[model samples]
Structures are given as structure tokens and as C-alpha cells.
Target: MRQNDAVAANAGPRVIVFIVFDGVTLLDVAGAGEVFAEANRFGADYRIKIASVDGRDVTTSIGIPLGVTDIAASIESADTVLVAGSDNLPTRAIDPALVEAVKAVAGRTRRLGSICTGSFILAQAGLLSGRRATTHWRNVRAFARAFPDITVEPDSIFVRDGDVFTSAGISSGIDLALALVEQDHGTDLVRDVARWLVVYLRRAGGQSQFSSLIEADPPPQSALRAVTEAIAANPGADHSVRSLAARASLSTRQLTRLFRSELGTTPAGYVEMVRIDIARSALDAGRTVTDTAHLAGFGSTETLRRAFVEHLGVSPKAYRDRFRTAIGT
Candidate 1:
């Protein structure tokens, strides 16, 4: 057994405490907690707890009430601490008491992490001042402006800097937790836990948080909007600039201008993005590489491979191996 595995084998269950607060996003807490619980169910020794500032009942953003322990008391012996995100973080100021409590607990914990905007709290506590971290994509710019010292990766699902980890919004918290489980036990256990949870065993941190399908938001009546919708609906159709211009009833030059002005990409670029998105979905569904290439409008496996690498930083076969759910391998 590895050193960490041997330690886990001899020691009692490691305590994984989640720090929650008013207006917390329930999924951030629930998702990570479920991952650890599933790991425990798979014979890993982990004890999970929900903790808050006062150990009182707190209302989640969606109005669910959760009972939590007082972090000041409960966190002293924690092996790992995760701060759950809050919807109110961007508007409201960080609580001084909570910051102090997090700082105190983090000082003694073996591992520390945050989920989504919980990174805001970690930043306030000075834990992330010199580390790389990430949060929700919507808040990435503001988070960077607020914490200039920390390197914020807006696209990553999760980032680990030394002993500290931070995940992107919502569901990515589950990914981070599974990664921690893999670190403590092994890949085999993590795979079992992931299969139980029905999630990818690993979505590499580099995978984008935003899919190309939803990246551009054009006006409802804009030609760019119509063209984008058409591309989405029929990814395999000819989406050359001339073809798209004809569909939108504009000259090719006019269509190119509109694409840049409204969607911030050329028509061809947008078409490639849409094709990549379609290819990802097709691959996830266990489609053959050749079939996915044709269906996604790449027309050949080589073309699809290049686009997959350019957009997703992985090859078609590698992407399929990591994310395919249909085969149940």
C-alpha cells in the first residue's frame, strides 16, 4: 500500500467538513457531500459534516433549511475543509467572523478547498492570495479584479494549488471531491465511486466550463442568432460563409461583419465551434469516431481530431475514453 493508503487504513475516518452559510447554493454542498459519502460507501474511511458560523439552522438560496454545527468547535479536528458557495457573495460583503473561522480551521487542516463563489471567502481569508484558483465563469472577471494576486482560471472545472483546491460552479464540486478521494485511496476506488454517482471519473481540469453551444448570446432577431440556431439544429449541413450568408439573406461580407459584431467570431469559427460541440455530444453517446466526424460536419476523422484538439485540448478517442457513458466501461 502507498503511504497515504496505509495511513488511511490505520487511522480512523478522516473528517470532511463543509462550511455553509446563509444563502449558500445547496448543490455546492450537496454535490461534494454526496461524493464523499459515496466514497465511504465504497469502503473508504471518510466522515462528512455540515458546519456553519453559529451551528444554527440556515436557509439555502432555494429556501431549503439545513442544520449545521458550529465551525469554531467542529472544525478544529477536521482533516479536510470545504467552503460552500453562496449566491449572495457578489453583492454582500464577507462576514468577518466567518473569515476568521475559516482562517483558523484552514491553518490546521491537512487539505482545504472551496466550491464556486466560496473562493471569495477563501480569498478574503488570505488563503488564496498567492495561489491559483477558479470560480464560476460569470464571476471570473470580478473575482480577478478583486483578488489580483491570485491567478484565476475561468475555464477550469477545478484547480489544485498545493494543498488548496477550488472548483468551478455547482456540479464541478463533485469532480473536486472525487479527485480528493482518488488522491487518498486510488484510481480504482474513485472509478467505482464515479460509476455509482454516474459521473465521469475524471473531467480533466482543463475541460471548459462553458460549452461552445452557449458561448455566444446574440439578439433574438439578429441574423447571427438565426444562423447559430440553424447550425445547432443541423450541424452536418453546409455552414460555409456563403451558405450561411445566403440563409441569412446577406452577402458573405455582410455576414462576416455581423458574425464578428454580434457573436464575436467569424462565421467559419462559429461553425467549427458548433461542430465541436456536436461532436462532443455524439462521442458521449458512444458514436464511432468516423460517424461523429460526419455527423458533426467535420466530414473525416482527421478533421474531427484536429478540431477536438484545438477546442478541447484532447483527441477524439481520448475524449471518448474519459467521458463516454453509453458503453458503461
Candidate 2:
């Protein structure tokens, strides 16, 4: 079937099935479900369901119980099938039955998606082979190693390759669901849903999952951590290699080597990433583009715009227009 063809075929509500498993991440299942539920509230016709290998109750990673239907019953005529992520991935063995079921379901569904480590499930089912996909940034190396045939885009928030979609981490599932909603309905409705949920209507799929402040791996108890913390705290400061090296009590060559060894980036690259993260947050908070540029230490709006486009694949104004909540609208 063509992507979204099932939704368009029947004049009735589209059936969205969440394929969950034992030790699933609760947010991966709930976050995407909430977006579709909110879309329904905005007048979109969609019906959601939670399904597992067998029709039974499954415990989430955090010990929450979720009731689910059997995959056999749920996949009968699904418009969209989303495979929810698991906390026990890469290390845990997936049921062969579940993999076979997913392979069968993919042929019948209009579109299929996986959230975070759920991409591993899809890949195991052979659904993601030869497709461009992504998962949690932390798992990218392992995923690539396991599935050499799949093209993994580690930095992307989400990726859409033909009828298959994949999202990074937990919250990114919400972004993918919102994108699906926009595809099935329209931007206005998805925008309203995003407003209600207080999230970006659409964080560009190309946006990096790693924020230098949060995701960068710095050596513990090392000067590199201090330098990174300083950069994050004062993004507006002069973060040239010389300035940062002095603050870290290291020579410029020492700082550069430490950054590359500990953080996998050059000192200048690390500074730019931190600045971009700050600028993105400021834009999401509804700050003016020009003001955000200066505040994030880009020196000028034009410079900031280039950084946004280079890093996020979208202009700053476009990102803000899509994500900034209208305070009283």
C-alpha cells in the first residue's frame, strides 16, 4: 500500500497500532500516542491501540503496567504501525515470533515507524534494511555495527525513508508522530496539537539529537569538563581556543588534544555546538532571532542564521515559527 493510503481509503478513522514489547520505554509508547490523541481532539479521525506479541499486560522498564492486544489482532488493518522502543535493546534477545509478525505487518500497513531503540526491532525484522534510519544517539555505533546494510543517520532527530520512519530517543517519538499527523491532516491542526502539548510542531528531522551541554562525553574530573561547563554557562563569552585553554589552565595545543580525546571534537567545534544549543533554546522560548544571535555569542543574526541552517537544516525564524508557543493565542 502507498504511504497513508489506508487513511485515505476509508472515510472512517485511521487505525494506529503501537507494537510494544516487554521492558518497553513508557514514553516511547505514550508520547506518540498522546500526539495522535491530541490530533483527534483537533478533529482528525484516528484510533489508537497498544499491542504486544500476545494479548497480555506488559511491564514497562520503570515497572508501569500496560494492557495490550495481540499483534495478530491489531495488525489486521492498521493505517500506521509504530514499533515502540525498549530499554533492553541490543543486549536482549527479541522473540523470533515478534520479528516475523512485524515483517508480515509491514507489508499490510500504509506506513511503519520505530521509536528510539525500536529501530533495532525493525532492523531485526528486516524492515529497515537498505533504508535510511536513526535511533538514540548513544546507540548509533552499536546499531551501525549490528546492521551494516542500514544507513544510520546518528545526528537526526528523526528520519523518513519511503514508507518507513524512525525517531531518535524518547521525546523524538512525539516529533515523528506530529510529522505523521501533519502528513495525514495538515500543518494547522498539528500546530494546534503541538501548542496543546507545548512542544515543537516539527523539530526538523535533521536537527542533532546531541546537545553539547547534555550529551557530550567529557572526561570526569578533568579540565575538559570545566571548560565545557564554562562554555555552556557563558555561551556569550569569548570562547576562542586561547581563551578557553587559559581558563582550563592548559596550553592551546593541550586543550585541543584534550577536547579531541575526551569529547571527540575540536575546541572550536565544541564551542560552536554549545552556542547552537543555546540559540535553539532561546528561539524555542520565543526570543527574537537577532537577540538570540547576540545572546548565543554568534555576534550577528546572519551568523546565527547560517549556524542554524548548517546544524539544524532550518532557518532560525522557521524553527521559531513552527515551535514557539503563542502565549495567549
Worst 10 residues of 2 by lDDT: 205-214
Residue 193's lDDT in candidate 2: 97
**Every candidate's lDDT:** 0.84, 0.84
Query: At residue 195, what lDDT does model 2 achieve?
Result: 99
Point to the candidate with the largest lDDT. Answer: 2
Candidate 2: segments with Cα more than 4 A from true spot: 1-10, 204-209, 212-329
Tens-digit lDDT track of model 2 for 194-245: 9999997856536452443345568688988788888888888888899999
The digit string of per-residue lDDT tens for model 1 on 1-329 reads: 01143233437888888998889999998899999998988888888888888888789989989888565545656678899998788668999988988888786677899999999999999999989999987777679989999999877889999889999888889999999999889999999999999998876535461444446578888877778889888988888888999989999999999988887689888888888888888888999999999888888899998887766777889888878884546
lDDT of model 2 at position 114: 96
TM-score of every candidate: 0.68, 0.68
Q: Would you list the clashing residue pairs of candidate 2?
A: none
Error of 1 at 79 (Å): 0.6
Clash pairs (backbone) in predicted model 1: none
